[model samples]
Target chain A: MRKVAVIGAGMTLFRRRLLETGKEMCFQAVQMALEEAGLELKDVDAVVSGSAPDAFDGVHMKGEYLLDGAGGVRKPYMRVFTGGGTACFSPIAGWWHVASGLADVVLVVNEEKMSSITPHPQYAFANIWDPILDRPLKPNLVWIFAMEMNRYMTVYGIEKADIARVAVKNKRNAVDHPAAQLADPNITVDDVLNSEVMAWPVQRLDISPPSDGASALVLASEDVARQVSETPVWISGVGWCIDSTMWTNRDLSFPEYLARAAQQAYGMAKIENPRKEVDVVEPYDPFDYKELHHLEGLLLADKGEAPILTREGVTQRDGELPTCPSGGLMGVGNPIAATMGIKTGEIYWQLAGKAGRRQVPGSPQVGVCQAWGDLMQFSSVMVMRA
Target chain B: MVGEEYRRWEGDMEALYVYTAGVAGDRFFREIRDNERLMGTYCPECDVTYLPPRLYCETCFSELNEWEEIPNKGRVDAITVAYVDDKGERLARPKVLAMVRFLGANGGLIHVVDLPEEDVYRGMEVEVVYLPRGLRKGSFLDILHFKAI
Candidate 1:
């Protein structure tokens, strides 16, 4: 297998309602990525695309529908989806394309158009349930997150304020992101606490907004990458793993799926101590507590130590190890696929010394991007170095 | 994994659906059943067309232009076989779900197959199977399945 490097990254504005269709959203992102890498559609050898659910875009066979927009028309294009974790796994698929020597340059793209659904985007989540067991309960998507948040709070004795602090940090970070849609800093723990209770332990503000957007990354072999850009971010390790869909049967206090994936990634990257080896961390944060949940999974902090690290500002931009410096999903908009792109993209920019104002205080040598999705069914981890 | 099966009591009954509004959807499935054809929208600004239809073009950030008929004869993109139902029960039988690249179309659809499961292959040619007249509905299942030519 050859070494793979990310040469470029691009995305569309994360919005609540975009006039564009899913495929077009894909094109916008893919085109930008290619242009950034000084490549063209013809240069891509394969395409990899992903989306959370066809339910969100109101289209089945979504990957096929998104083919041409992703520049896969007649190429070897395949879509990979792991519900929400798809945002991260999609890029891993691209990494493999170049790594396997089957494709010299791979185009990775993902999109979620939640606006097409009426009333509430939550209605589309009615599909994630088990038709025979859980669906009968008519549960909304928020219920699952709420239950998990409650479990975390109970197990770690973490207060809602500590979790709310993530929302504060990410949203503030989004203020510097160009495509951010929810970059509101006026948010307070009281505001989050006072927000409408969609479910127990989860208020409206503790969650990411239902958004429509797309993101893309251009990945190439080390040879192609060196020719495209002077500073290419090398993919040191890539790992994706899945747990059973029986989310209700397990303890929701920690993401075991994430732990397993991180183990594989860290093992591949040859990192004995992740806290010291990884300078930046981008753990998924679809919900506020999730950031903390994944922090533990990433071993940035011990199982129950995320709350304390977060409370002490240790996870801030200038802290010991900056996490979600790009404002994360909570602040940037939860477009599912785009969040993962931002995580990986931030590492690219940071490595290239081009993150502008959001850059960490130093030239971080290594960074990690992790995401969780499905009914806690999947987790994907990737570690990159400059 | 196959041959082994289990049937435990499932608590309640629930159904999943993907809903869409505006004329794009209404016409999307409508044309498939009415004309036994597949269609997509073209974005004049981006110079790319779409399948599964859309009300707006995401690239140029403009509303989609008129619909264009795409051939229903393309290569098989990917496929998977299912031996279980939504209840996680192994079907007494197995079924094939395929993603076919319709002719002259940018995207394809996922549907059941009329061919024997063992005979199917990726990159094989296939065409849409329209509902016989009088059975038409403005839903995705309208086409029923795509069959080998």
Candidate 2:
């Protein structure tokens, strides 16, 4: 594979409610990313867009609906979705564009207008269940997550207090993120524990707020990258994996999907030990417990040991591992595909020494971004080095 | 750019989605309709058992042939009292959605909870509540919601 680099990144404010249409959000972010890359719409050779379910947007063939706004009007464009992993997968798609000599400049965009749906975005997920069997049970989306949290807590011997720490840390980190929607809150373990329970093991505070937003990143081949920017972040490796959709058949306490994906990325990146080799980590965290769950999956910590590292402050911003320095989807807000771009964008800034407040003390040399989704069936991982 | 008048679209669209019957979905609903407990199909080849049920073993590439019954009782994994519908419009009040995993099951299934919105939590015990025999529609809504056992 040829070398690929991120030339520029742009994103809209993550908000609970945005009057702008989904297309508008995409156009705005794409325009900004292109401008930052010192290019124009005409310079993009291919476009890749990703969003979760079209049910949330209430628009079918959403990729075709979003083509023009994503700058794919008459160019090569394709849409990819692996549930919530859509965002990270967008850039990985871009990576292959340059790697395969298909297109030199790829425009990657992701948008999720969860706010456009009514009643609850959770309701749209009702259809994601087995329509014949599980659907008849009248299961809501929260039930599966609740079951996973229960198993994680039981298997890891983690308490509600330990899970609360993630919410507190990520929210605190969001205070400095300009686009974060849930960035400010003086929350504690008691705060999370006392919040209303949406399910047995999940409280209101444990979940990230539904959001509407868009993000864009521009990727260029080695020659174009050098011409585009002085501080382009190099993409060393990209990998993605999918577990069986039969989620009930496997262990839910940890994400084996993420482990396989990470292994693929590490092999391509030629890293022996992820925990020791990678300088910064960003594991997808839509729920507080998920950060810990994915930490083990990413091999940042051994299975059943992530919670211990988290409790010891080893995964904190100033700690040994430094996970979710961008506040994650938990703190930064989750708008489906856009959440992963924030992780991608944050690594770009961190590797460039541009993260002002949430910056790791040391000048980070390597970083990893991971996203898990699709009823815990899909995982996407990318490794970047400065 | 075209004027607003020219930009308006006047047309119709039709789309369809096709899916295969996965591992446990068929038996899960069938057992529930028959008032029998249901779980997932476990493949000895991959050593993985599925919950919401499936048709094949993902790891071992074997056809799943067994439907294991698991206890209905399990701890809550996550919960939410969503105030808005799927369209993002605010409802008069919120409805509770919970992710619950059964004992010895690999994954949890989502369902509505009969418990008051305030009584839910991460580890609360809940049991499946089947719909009335006469009211069964063979759809996902057959079970109104799970309740605290």
TM-score of each: 0.76, 0.72
Give the per-residue lDDT of model 2 (tens digit) for B35-97. Answer: 646567777776777786655443333456787887778788999898899999998877899
Q: Model 1 shows how many backbone clashes?
A: 7
Q: What is the lDDT of residue B49 in candidate 1?
A: 78
The DockQ assigned to candidate 2 is 0.01
Model 1 has a DockQ score of 0.07
TM-score (chain A) of candidate 1? 0.98
Which numbered prediction scores highest in TM-score against the true structure?
1
lDDT, model 1: 0.82
lDDT of 2: 0.82
Off by over 4 Å in 1: B1-149
Q: What lDDT tens digits, residue by residue, belong to model 2 across residues A1-386? A: 79999988888889887755676677778777877788877778889998898987777888998776677877888999888988789899989999999999999999888876675777677778876567767788888989999999998788888888888888888887888888865767788889999998999989998988999999999999998788889999788999888888988988877888999999999999888899998888999999988888888888778778878998888999888988888888999898865789888878878788889879999999988788778989999998
lDDT of 1 by residue, A1-386 (tens): 79999888888899888766777777778777878898877788888988888777878799998776777777898988888888889889888888889999998988888887777776777767787787777778788888888998998898888888888888888898898989986777778888888887898889889888899899999889988888789899888888777887889888877888998999988989998999998889888889999999888899878978999999999999899988889988888876656778778877777788889988999999988888876889999999
Could you tell me which 10 consecutive residues in candidate 1 chain B have the lowest summed lDDT? Answer: B12-21
